[model samples]
Target: MSKTQQLSKIGNFFRAFGSAVAVAEATRLGHQPVASDLRALGIDPVQFKSIYRR
Candidate 1:
């Protein structure tokens, strides 16, 4: 991969990782997670809540 493309991938990896960590921490603390962070991990916030309702 080109240097720029590799850098972009690295950045995306960290961004996604950060989002996952934020969501996990929020849920652990009994707080609402950010919808954008959930979406970053390919989760739909609405459907995710519905799963808990079942």
Candidate 2:
């Protein structure tokens, strides 16, 4: 996707998360929770630095 399209998708996710938080105090995700899934676990999400991305 183009940069703009990627940003739009990220915006959509933020909107979804905002709505979800408003609807319920907590959001659940399937399987074991990893560091990346922390947001769904009602905690702050963190991004680890990868050689390519960071």
Candidate 3:
């Protein structure tokens, strides 16, 4: 697969996983772990925070 396609697939996986995790945690704990949510979406909060801060 092309690099773009691979990246897109990864993104899709992250979105699906993140959503699932958010729902599960909301059901079990009554609160969402936002960092875990981002991680499920294949994102690192530390990395994102750094980039976003700029």
Candidate 4:
């Protein structure tokens, strides 16, 4: 793949991984939710929440 494509793939991987981790953490912290988990992962809660919701 071209450099840009490679970078895109990497970005996609991280995004998916982050979403999975956020889901797991949200399940673990019953009171909190995936948005909070995304925040913990250093992502903007609102934006990440929107992405994860998709």
Candidate 5:
């Protein structure tokens, strides 16, 4: 892969990792995670809410 593509992939990976961490922290705190963060993790925010159903 090109250097630019490799860098892009790394950046995306970090962003997704950050989103996952944010989601975990929010859930741990008994709060709903941000919709954008859920999307970053390839999750549908609405479905996630339904599954949790609080």
Candidate 6:
């Protein structure tokens, strides 16, 4: 697959995983992670923050 497609697949996983992580953290904090913010996966394709959180 092309680099773009590869990134997208990775992005999808990151998006889903990140959403889950955010939701978990938010739940602990008494709030929910907004789904729209993570939608950046479509435009930005992988969030470095998600792939390499520190």
lDDT of 2 by residue, 1-54 (tens): 899999999997896676555434323322223443455535543332121221
lDDT tens digits, residue span 1-54, model 4? 799999999997887777777677775665345564465556676654454331
Question: What overall lDDT goes with each candidate model?
Answer: 0.90, 0.50, 0.66, 0.65, 0.93, 0.59
Q: Which stretches of candidate 4 lie over 4 Å from their true place?
A: 31-54
Superposed model 5: Cα runs more than 4 Å off:
none
Per-prediction TM-score: 0.89, 0.45, 0.50, 0.55, 0.89, 0.49
What is the clash tally of candidate 3? 1
The C-alpha stretches of model 3 lying farther than 4 A from their native spots are: 30-54
- Ten residues in sequence with the least summed lDDT for candidate 1: 45-54
Instruction: For each of the candidates, give the backbone clash count.
Output: 0, 0, 1, 0, 0, 0
Candidate 6 achieves a global lDDT of: 0.59
Badly placed stretches (over 4 Å) of model 2 are: 25-54
Give the distance in Å from residue 33's predicted Cα in candidate 5 to where it truly belongs. Answer: 0.1
Q: Where does the lowest 10-residue lDDT sum fall in candidate 3?
A: 45-54
Regions of candidate 6 where Cα sits further than 4 Å from its true position: 35-54
* Error at 51, model 6, angstroms: 31
| TM-score for candidate 6 | 0.49
Supply the TM-score for candidate 1: 0.89
Q: Model 6: per-residue lDDT, tens digit, 1-54?
A: 999999999988887778767756864676534655445433232442344432
| Model 2 TM | 0.45
